[model samples]
Target: MGSRNSDRIPIQMRRRKCETVADMAAQGWDVLSKCQACGLVMRVNLKMIAKVSGPATSLWNRKQRCRRVGCTGFIEFQGRAPDMHWHETLAAPSDGEM
Candidate 1:
């Protein structure tokens, strides 16, 4: 017999792993995320680490936010050093808004 839907996988396992903004920048990656609840998109600047974390900004973590007028979406960013150019997009669902 096959496993039930609820038993197939844990809810946490189905969710994508969250990464810090700094991690993305270090890997030469920038994130363009949009809110699933609203059609709000934001560009997270991982490059801002130099202003706070020093020259080796790639080793630091930065905070990111959604620019939507009333959106309270936020994400943690800890960019990693990458050998090639990288860009990523993510979808955020406002907590309690869904």
Candidate 2:
């Protein structure tokens, strides 16, 4: 009935949820939008969004249309952390370029 990792707190409880645009901005997160039809991926303009809409705007479950020429598509959004691509000094040469 004894376990070494039993006392450790769960990762879910330790992690903070970034719900709103303000929360994402405060935590250094970028909102990435991918086009459904054209398959183009681009970072969303959070500052412009916040100004036009509100800082409390939620990215999920929103029906956003893509503004690309000659393409009728929707945008799928996702959040990305700043350090996701790996920090400069920590990457190994064996890993190669991404």
Candidate 3:
């Protein structure tokens, strides 16, 4: 029973790798918005874009909200899985925490 449960968890995680924002209402990924010219960073509401663009759009090279008088940067949208942390991803056995 333990083995079976472990097996399903991996499969579930794999299924959640829905890269496209196609399912706008899906609650797994978080989008981060960053501006290069103004150094502005924030989380954006994708609901508006998803509705207009049919939810299959990637925020990869989008430009928005940087209308400052002298700012001339494009907003970069990045989607990331909420469950992953950089430190936990890999560790050497010598690190001892493992």
Candidate 4:
């Protein structure tokens, strides 16, 4: 039984890999937005970009609210930046953790 389960593990892993590849293919370039006030950038992964936009927008809105008495117009859109490969490297799961 243990050997049988072990054999199934590779099959399961292959399925997961195929699913991830399909998801990656379905998602093209991601659209990102930035807040001018705090220079906070929100990266929207295209797979579920629309679903996540509200939270990202809310974060920017909350950041715009000034606790200080003299501040006004705290939030503005700064625009997008080119996606960086370093981010992918950082996001990859470490072998040790796996």
Candidate 5:
């Protein structure tokens, strides 16, 4: 007699392993810190490190909102450094402005 589904332990174990790897990859970048002055949020790749600091800070706290009154440019934490052109968008506030 041939092995049936009940005897397919190796197949089931392989499937479980694949699922675990997929789950790990899915847990990508999570917000880590925020700059209160500019409302810029910093995100760190969670899966990269085994442990993370700043347990007191909430993940959502790093979410950046639109700086402009009506502009929809939401702040985001990028893994790599941004290009020089991107910095041009940040307008310097005048002496009177906060």
Candidate 6:
């Protein structure tokens, strides 16, 4: 009798308040976004931050797809600035490390 399955969908618990990317960086909080359709999690990075800083873009309005194969689900980010200005650091490989 149901036209769509409810159990297959994911429940997204996004941040209730929106904050700027700079604020998040200042507070030591990484932009955490979860897929609303499949519960997949994606962290905001420098690239993502730069991508949304164009003339018309928003971090919260960005949509991404679930990484799992065969999962016909899409995720959107909300409750914050659509861009950021931070980058994560990684340890450099020593001597002959590729």
lDDT, each prediction = 0.41, 0.59, 0.50, 0.32, 0.33, 0.44
| Candidate 5: residue 6 lDDT (0-100) | 34
Better of 5 and 6 by TM-score: 6
10-58, model 5: which lDDT tens digit per residue?
Answer: 3223223222222323433222333445565544454443344322222
Give the number of the best model, judged by lDDT: 2
> What range of 10 consecutive residues in model 5 has the weakest lDDT sum?
80-89
The C-alpha local distance difference test score for the whole of candidate 5 amounts to 0.33
The residue-by-residue lDDT of candidate 4 on 11-73, one tens digit each, is 223223222322432434233444445544555454453354432222111224433445443
Span of 10 residues, lowest total lDDT, candidate 3: 86-95
Worst 10 residues of 6 by lDDT: 9-18
Query: What's the lDDT of the predicted structure labeled candidate 3?
Result: 0.50
Q: Give per-candidate clash totals.
A: 14, 0, 0, 0, 0, 2
Q: Evaluate residue 35 in candidate 3 and report its C-alpha lDDT on the 0 to 100 scale.
A: 68
Q: Rank the candidates by lDDT, best first.
A: 2, 3, 6, 1, 5, 4
Local lDDT at 87 for model 1: 29
For model 3 the local lDDT of residue 28 reads 57
Q: How far does residue 33 in candidate 4 sit from its true spot (Å)?
A: 1.4
Q: lDDT value for candidate 6?
A: 0.44
Q: 1-98, model 3: which lDDT tens digit per residue?
A: 43343323332242334434654237555666776678676765667667787677654334576755677876665554444331111112323222
Q: What are the runs in model 6 whose C-alpha is more than 4 Å off?
A: 1-29, 51-56, 78-98
TM-score of 2: 0.62
Q: Evaluate residue 95 in candidate 3 and report its C-alpha lDDT on the 0 to 100 scale.
A: 30
Model 5 pairs whose backbones collide: none
Better of 2 and 4 by lDDT: 2
TM-score of each: 0.35, 0.62, 0.53, 0.25, 0.20, 0.38
